[model samples]
Target: MQIRDLPYADPGVPDVRSGTRFLLWLGRQQLGGQVKCLLWGLLHHLGIAGLPLGVGLAVQAVVDRDGGRLALAGVLLLALGAAIAAGDVMLHRTAVTNWITAAARVQQLLSRKTAELGSVLTRRVAAGEVVAVSTGDVERIGWFVEALSRFAAAAVTLVVICVGLVVYQPALGVVVAAGIPVLALAVLPLLPHAARRADVQREKAGKATELASDTVAGLRVLRGIGGEELFLGRYRAASQEVRRAAVHSARMWALIAAIQVVLPGLLLIAVVAYGTKLALDGRIEVGELVTVYSAVALTHHALRNFEEIAQAFSFSRPSAKRAARVLSLTRTTTTVPKPREVEAGGDLYDPLTGLRAPAGLFTAVVCGDPDVAGRLADRLGGHPTEPDADHTSVLLGGVPLDELPLEDARTVVLVQDKEPVLLSGTLRELLDVPTSGKVRAEHALAAAQCDDVLDALAQASVATGGDPMLTRITERGRSLSGGQRQRLALARSLFADPEVLVLDEPTSAVDAHTEAAVATWIAELRRTRTTVVLTSSPLVLDRAHCVVLVHEGQAVAVGSHRGLLATEPRYRAVVTRETDEELATADGRAVELDALEGESA
Candidate 1:
C-alpha cells in the first residue's frame, strides 16, 4: 500500500488477538510494499558487501599490473555505487509509505470504532488512553512494521557475508563468522531491562497526557471554582514523574547502545588482528586480508540493524497491545436474529422500569438519581449505555428495540444526551445533521427557544463582517455560554424530527423563564409525536401529558402532574420540594381554576 492509496479502500478487519499477531496482520495487509522494501534493502546491503570484494580485486589488479583488470574493477565499483544509491532512495520511499499506510489503517479502524460506540466509548476506555493509542501508539506500530523489511535484509546480508568470507579465506572466516552472532545476540540480555523501563516510561507518559487532556477539557470549570492552580500543580507533578521515567528508560537504552558499539568494535579488532597474523604468515594474500578486514567493518554496520529492530519491538509491543485491546471490544448484547426496522411514531416502553411513553404524547420521567434517569434514557433507545444483560427489553411498536438494526433504531428514537456535543462548525452546518427533514430549521430553533443563540451568533458574525451561516464556531462551542450551547444542541435535536425524541435534562442549564418557554414550545411542537423527557423540573413536568415518578430505579407512580402532586409523596418531594400543605393549596387553586373554566365554557 502506498501513501496515495491511503485510507485504504478497505482497511480490512484487524487481528485483535494479540500485539504480535496484530503486527503480523499489518505486515500481511501490505505484503506487496514489504516485498518492495525488502528487495531494495537487500540490494543496498549487498552493494555495501560487494565494496570489499571490489577493493580486493582492484588491489590484485594493481599488484599484477593488469590495466584491463583494473578498469573492470573500477566499472564494477561504479555499478555497485549506483545500485547502492538507487536502492537506498527507493528503500526509504517504500519504508515511509509502509509506515504511513499502517498508521492510517489503524487510525481508520479506531475512527470506525468510535463512531459505532458513540458516547459509550469514553465510559469503556480512558479518554487519554484513546488519544495515546490513536496518536503515538499507531506510529510505533507502523515503525516496527516498516523496520521488519530492513531487519530481514540485514539478516540475509550477514549470512551471505559470512559464507563469502569462509569461501575466500576459511581461517579469517571462522573468527569473523563466530563473532557476528555474538554481536547480534549480545543485546538480548539487556533487552528485558530496556523493555521494562520503556513500559514504565510509556505508562507515566500516558498518565501525564491524560491529566493534561482532562485539565484542558475542564479548564473553564476549574477557573470558575478557583481551582486552576490546584490542577496546574497536579499536572506539573505528573509532568515531572513522566520526565523521570523517560530519563530512566533512556539510561537503559543508552547502556544497550554502548554495548552495541563496544561489542562490534571488539569483533572488528579481533578480525583485523587475526587477519594481520595470517597475512604475516603468508597464509592469506594481502588482497584477501584487506577484503576480510573490510567485511568485518561492514558486518558491524549490519549488526546495528539488529539493535534497532530490538528497540523497535520493545516500544511497539505495548502500543500494539493497547490498540488490540480497543479493537477487541464488542457489543455485549447478542445479535438480534432477523433484525427489523421500528415503526414510526411507535410507543417507547421499558419493561425493566415499567415506564412507558405512549405514542404521540409527552411523558416526563422524574428520578431521584440523575444516573438512573440517564441509564433509562439510554435503555429507551436500542443501545444500553451499560454492558449488562439484566436490562429489560424496550419495545417500539411491539418490536424489541434491540432487534432493530442500529441505524433503523436510531432513526426511530433519537436520544438527546444531558451534555450533547456541538461540533465546531457554522450555525447552519451544526443544524444540518442527518434527519427526516420534516421540521424546518427556523421552526425547530423556535421550538428550542434559541433566539438568544441566533442573536449571539449574528452579533459575532456581524462583528467579523462575515455571513452568519459561515461564522466559525470554536471547538466544542467553548466560546458559547452553557445555556447557549444547551439551546443550540436542543435546536439541533429538534431539527432532526425523529419518530421518538428522548431528551435528558434538556433545559437544566437555562433559567426558569427560558426553561418554561422551552418546555411549552417543545410540548406544543411535539404534541403529535412520542417525547420522553427525563427531568424533574416542575415547568417541564407540568407540561407533560403524563408524569412517571421513578424511585429506587423503578417507576413507582404514573399520573397527571396535578394528580401526582395531590397523591404520591415521593413524587412531590422529588419534583416540588414543597410541603403537602403548599402542594394542597396549589392543587386546590388548580381545581378552582378548572371549575371556573368549566363554568365559563
Candidate 2:
C-alpha cells in the first residue's frame, strides 16, 4: 500500500477492513508489473505445450513421404523452442521485480510508522517484533504478491492448451481437463491446517528472538546478581519451544509437498492409461495419440506451479498481517499537544504527582521508591506515554507540560541520570555533544569535574571519529566505569544548559569524595537557575536549598536537609543509612554549611 494511506489502515485482524485491504492496496500499486509477468508466463507455458504437437506433426509429415512438410515442421519446432526460452527469461525477470517492489513498499510504510511513533515504538511493541517485521516478513509478503500474477498466468495458459487439444482431439482434451482440476484441488484441504501451524511456528520464533534480545541487554545486570544461569536456562527452554513449533510446521508442509507430487502423478497415470485404451480402439491415430499423451505431461508441469502458489500464499498472508499491525500503530490517537498561550515566567508544575519546581530555585526530590522516580523522569522528558499509563500535568510557568511543543519542552527541561551514556568518543567530544554552541565544552567539563576523566581517556588512547581525542566507543561504552559514564552524561546535559535541569542521583555511582565534590560544583553552577535533583544520597541532598521527600508517589515533606532531619522522621530515615551517625559525630562536631550556600550566591 502507499505510505500515505498506511496511517488510516486498521490492524484488528480477521476482518476484511484491515490486513486484507492493505495487501490488496499493495497489489494494486504494481498492477502493471503483475500484468507483464502474467503475459510472459502464458507465452512460456504455450511454448512448452506446443512442443509435443510439433513433434506429432513432424512424424505425420515424415510418414506421408513429404520432405517439404517435414522441413517446415522442423522450422516451426525451432521457432517454438526459441519463443519458450525467451518467455522463460522474461517471466523470471518480471516476477522477481514485482516481488522486490512489493517488499520495498511495505518497508517504506513500516519506516514511516516508526518515524511517526518515535520513542513510543518500544513501549508499544517488542523490539524483536520490529526486527522480524523489517526482515523476514517483508520478503514473504513480496513473494505472495508476485505469486498472484503468476498464478493467473499459469491457469490461463493451462486453459488455452486444453481448449486447443479438444479441438484437435476432443477425447484427449476432456481427459486432461478432468485431471487438472483434481491435481489443483488436492492441496486446498491441507492449506488451512498448514497455515494454522505456520502461524504458531512464527509466533514461537518471535518469542525466541525477544528472549535472546532481552537476555543480551540484561547480561550485565544478570551477572551482577548471579542470575545469569537462571536467565540462560529460561532462554534455552524458549529456544526448545521454538524448535518444537518448527518441527510441527515442517511436518505439515512436508505432507502437503508429498500430496503435491503424488496427486499430479495420479493424473499422469490416468492420462497414459486412458490414452492407451483409445489408441487400441483405433479412434485416434498413433501420431495424435502420442500428441495427446505429450499434452498430458505438459499439463502436469503447469499444475505443479499451482502448488508453489499455494505455499507462497500460505506464508505471505500471515506476514502481511504482521506488517499491517506495525503500520496500524501510527493511527493511534494518543499524542501530547502544546498550549496556545503561556506565561513567560512561572514554576514548572506536575499535576499527576502534585509536584512543582519553583522558578530559579534548587529543589531536591527524594523518592523512597526509585521505580516511581524513574517513571516520573521519563514522563518529564516528553517521551511517549506508556500503555494504561498514569501521568500528572507537568506545567512550565503554569502551562501544562503536554501543551508545550515537544521541541520547546525539551529545550526547557533536561533529565540527567547517574548512569549517563558515554557514546564512543573522546572526553572532549562527549562534553561537546548536542554540539550546540550554547554551552562550551570546557565550561561543561569544568562544572562536572571531568578533568580526571579526560586524563583517563588519554591514557587509554580512546578515539571515536578517528580523531585521537574523538575516537569511537564500542557498543554502550563498555570501556568506561560506572562513575566515568555518569560524569560524562552529566557533562553533556550541562552543555545543553536548559532552563530546568533534572538530575536523578547524578553522583550515586561515584566515590564519596567525588560525590561531595560534584554535588558542590553542581550547586555552584546551578545557582539562581531552576534545578530539580531526584536523589537519595546524603551528599547531593546536603547541597539543595530545599529538599522534598516523596513517599509512595506523593510529596510527604518539604524543607532543607537539616530542617527535614529535625522535623520529618520519614525524610531522616530515607536519606541517612545510619540515623545515629549524625548523632554519634554531633558532640563538638558542628560544621557550618553556610559557606557552601554563600559560594552558590
Candidate 3:
C-alpha cells in the first residue's frame, strides 16, 4: 500500500479475542509488505555473508601471486557491495512502509470503534487506556510487526552463512559456525525476565496516565471544592511509581543488551584464536584463517537481529493486550436493526415506567432522582445506559424503536444528551449536521438565547473580520462559559429539528433569566412537534403544556404545572424541593410565573 492510501477505506473487523490474535490479524493484513521486506533482508544479509569468502580469495590469490585470481576476487567484492547497497535500501524502504501502514490501520480501527460506541466508550473503557493506545501503543505494535520479517531473514542468513563456512574450510569453518549459533542463542533466557519487567512498567504507566486524565478532567471541580492539591499529590505519586517501574524495566533490558554484546565478542575471539592455532599447525591455510575470522565477525550482525526481535516483542506484547482490551468493550444493544420507519406524531411510551407522553405535546417530566431522568432520556431514544437486557423498547407512535434501523430511529427521535459535546470547529460547522431543515440557524440561536455567545465569538475572531458564524470553537467548547456552552449545544440540537426531541435538563447550567427565556423559546419553536423535557425547574414546567411527575422510576401523576402544584402533593415536593413556598391557589401560582407564556398551538 502507498502512503496516499495509508488509511484503508475499511480496516475490516479485527479479531479482538486477544492481544496475540489482534497482532496476528495485523500481520496478516500486510502479508505482501512483509514478504517484500523478507526478500530484501535476505539479499542484504547474503551480500554481507559473502564478504569473508571474497576476502579469503584475495589473500590466497596474493599469497600465490596469481593476477587472474586477484582480478576475480576484486569482481566478487564489487558484486557483493552492490547487492548489500541495493538490498539495504529496499529493505529499509519496505520495513518503514510496513510500520506506517500497520500503525494507520490500527488507528483507523480504534477511530471507527470510538465513533460507533460514541460517549459510551469512555464509560466502558478507561479514558487513560484509550489515550495510551492511540498515542504510544500504535507505534509499539507497528514496530514489532515490522521487526518480524527482518528477524526471519536474519535467521535464514545465519543458516546459509554457517553451511557455506563449513563447506569452504571444514576444520576452522566448523568452529566458526558452531560459535555463531551459540552466541545467537545466549540472550534467549534473559528475555522472560525482561518481559515481566516490561509488563510491570506498562501497568504502572497506564495507571499514571489514567490518574493524570482524571485530574485534568476534574480540575475545575477540584478547584471549586478546594481539592486541587489533593488530586495533584495523588497524580504526582502515580507518576513517581511509573518512573520507578520504568527504571527497573530499563535495568533488565540493559542486562540483556550486555549479554548480546559480550556473548558475540567472546564467540568472535574464540573463532580467531582457534583459527590461528590451526593455521600455525598447517591444519588450515593463512588465507582460510582470515576468512574464518571475518565470517565469524559477520555473524555478530545476524545475532544482533535476534536480540532486537526479542526486545521488540517484549515491549509490544503488553501494548497489544491493552489495545485489545479497549477494543473488546461492547455496548449492550437494545435495538435489533430492522428496515422500518415510524410515522410522525406518536406518543412516547416507556413500558417499564408506565410513562406516556401524548403526541405533538410539549411535555415536562420531573423525576425526583436526576440519575433516573438521565437514563430515561436515553431509553426514549432507543439508547439504553443501563446494563439490564430486560428493557423493552420505548415505543414511538405504537412502533417499537428497536425494530427501526438506528439511523431511522435517531432521525425521528433526537436525544439532546445531558452533556452535549461541542467538537472543535467553526460555528457554522458545529451547526452543520443532518437536520430536517425546518428551523433556521438564526431562529435556533435566538430561541436558545445564544446571542451573547455569538457576540463574544465574533469579537474573538477579529482575524475573520468579525464573523461569528465562521468563528472556531474550542474542543468541548472549553473557551466558552458553562452556560454559553449549554446554550450553544441547545441551539445546535434545535437546528436539527427532529420529529420528536428529547432533552434532559438542557438549561440546568444557565441562570434563571436565560433558563426562562430558553424554556419559552424552545416551547414556541417546537410547537406541534413531539417534545419531552426532563426537568424539575419551575420555569420550564410553567411553559410545558403537559407535566408528568415521575417518582421512584414510575409516572405518578400527569397534568398542567399549576394543576400539579395545586392537587399533587408528591409533584409539588419534587418540583418545589429548592423553594418550598406554598401557593394557595391556581391564580396565585399563575401570577408567580406571569412572565412565562405557554406554547401557542
Score every model by TM-score: 0.92, 0.76, 0.89
lDDT of 1 by residue, 1-601 (tens): 6687677777889999998999999999989989999999999999999999888889988988989998999999999999999999998999999889889999999988886666666768899999999999999999999999999999999999999898889999988888888888988999999999888888889899899989888889999999999999999999999899989989988998899889878887887888888889988888888888888887766777898899999999999999999987743354557887666766788877888889999999999889888878777866576655564578898888777776777677888889888898888889878887678889889988888777777788965575566677888899999998999899888889888999999999999999999999998888788999999999999999999998997788999989997788789878877777887787789899999999999
**Residues 463-568 of candidate 3: C-alpha lDDT, one tens digit per residue:** 8999999999988888898889899999998999998999999999999999999999988999979899999999999999999998887898989999998878
Error of 1 at 323 (Å): 1.8
Cα shift from native, residue 356, model 2 (Å): 3.1
Output the worst ten-in-a-row residue range by lDDT, candidate 2: 7-16
- Return the TM-score for candidate 2, rounded to 2 decimals: 0.76
Winner on TM-score (1 vs 3)? 1
Where model 3 places Cα greater than 4 Å from the true spot, the runs are 222-228, 334-359, 389-413, 555-557, 566-569, 578-601
Instruction: Assess the local accuracy of residue 598 in candidate 3 as a C-alpha lDDT between 0 and 100.
Output: 46
lDDT of the candidates, in the order given: 0.87, 0.75, 0.86
lDDT of 3: 0.86
Q: What is the lDDT ranking, best to worst? A: 1, 3, 2
Q: Name the better of 1 and 2 by lDDT.
A: 1
RMSD of each: 4.5, 7.1, 5.8
lDDT accuracy of residue 159 in candidate 1:
93
Which portions of model 1 miss their true places by more than 4 Å?
A: 335-338, 389-393, 463-466, 578-601
Best by TM-score: 1
Q: For candidate 1, which ten residues in a row score worst on lDDT?
A: 328-337
Winner on lDDT between 2 and 3 is: 3
